[model samples]
Target: MNPTPPPTIVIVPGLRDHVADHWQTRLAQRLTAAGRAVHTVPPLTGERLALDAQVANLAATLTPLSGPVLLVAHSAGVITTVHWAARHSADVRGAILATPPDFETPLPDGYPTPAELAHHGWTPVPREPLAFPSIVAASADDPLGAPERVAAMARAWGSHLVDLGAVGHLNPASGHGDWPLAEELIATLESGPALAPIGATPTGEPG
Candidate 1:
């Protein structure tokens, strides 16, 4: 029998760690059931939590995983992953960024503006090609960012973009308790090209 593939799925949850029943949490469970090792980083909280600490934590998480590593990041977690990857390219094989909030855009009322985000040390994404392939998935109605902004980020990072229709923020609050589509997307990322658009039907085959 063929040996099982290396377990290298690193799941980075958003502002807070995914709660029970959240799609990201469910996806991590599913991957684990399939014999893949999954790591969920602790949530970054408090204004005092340094962004560099978060980046370092991510790097530490990636260190022991065998390659080619596949990174799965959601929301603000996407920013963390990208920032870490830009500096630690050798640690990652590819990435799937979901519903990334654009720091370049103006914030909504009661939200921090881009400058404020930067003031808090959330840096703008680097403008160089990533060491590995990456796919960015966004929704039509994400309150934190526009589709165009997400697409532009993908282009800048040399990644692929997928537009999920009207799926507000693609988070648990949006009623996406268990996103089977995201599982399919992960399977696709494991097999084929690094970047595939959203809504592209997978050809019949395991990744």
Candidate 2:
């Protein structure tokens, strides 16, 4: 008998969409070079802030794929995954959610305001535990999401929390390129159980 194949990698970008210097883009390029199946969700050209549209796009991306899928999401993309989980069911094996911004709270000057997020159907994030295994890699000093708040979100989603320390938003503007930690985390998630949500809440601090 043949061994089981690896899951397809699905890179889900944030509100800003794909960036040439983004770590997700780099990971996708590297994975494809290594003969791994990889796909990145295309950014919406219109209705950029509509959460429903984003969810539909993600679903459409996954609809044609066969076998298991591992979602690698960042920033608003993490929120998009949770929203997708709430309404849709697919062959999602796992997810790596990095530096998810807090939509309920008012973001910084340049980001979308809480009112805008609410009006666009991004606020009131889904708090139900996810059906699939997931890792929420949060930054201690991320300007987008406070540590405590993200920790709470991880717990609500029944996800394992990984403290990424002070990596800002883990984006190109945050000085992160080709994030090697993501590779390690992805490996762990790949070999992990189907649903590994920790029963107890963690301290939410880096040990």
Q: What TM-score, over all chains together, does every model reach?
A: 0.85, 0.93
Query: Tens-digit lDDT track for model 2 on 119-197?
Result: 9999899999999889898898899999899989999998998877788888888788778878787888888755445
Q: What is the lDDT of residue 179 in candidate 1?
A: 74
> Who wins the lDDT comparison?
2
Return the TM-score for candidate 1, rounded to 2 decimals.
0.85
Q: What are the Cα lDDT values of the candidates? A: 0.74, 0.88
lDDT of 2: 0.88
lDDT per residue (tens digit) for residues 1-207 in model 1: 987575378888776754997777888899899878788876656542356878887887777666567788888888888788767755465677888987777867876777877776786666666777777777888899887778778788877777677888777678777777666667767775645543342322111
Name every residue pair that clashes in candidate 1.
162-198
Give the lDDT of residue 129 in candidate 1: 66
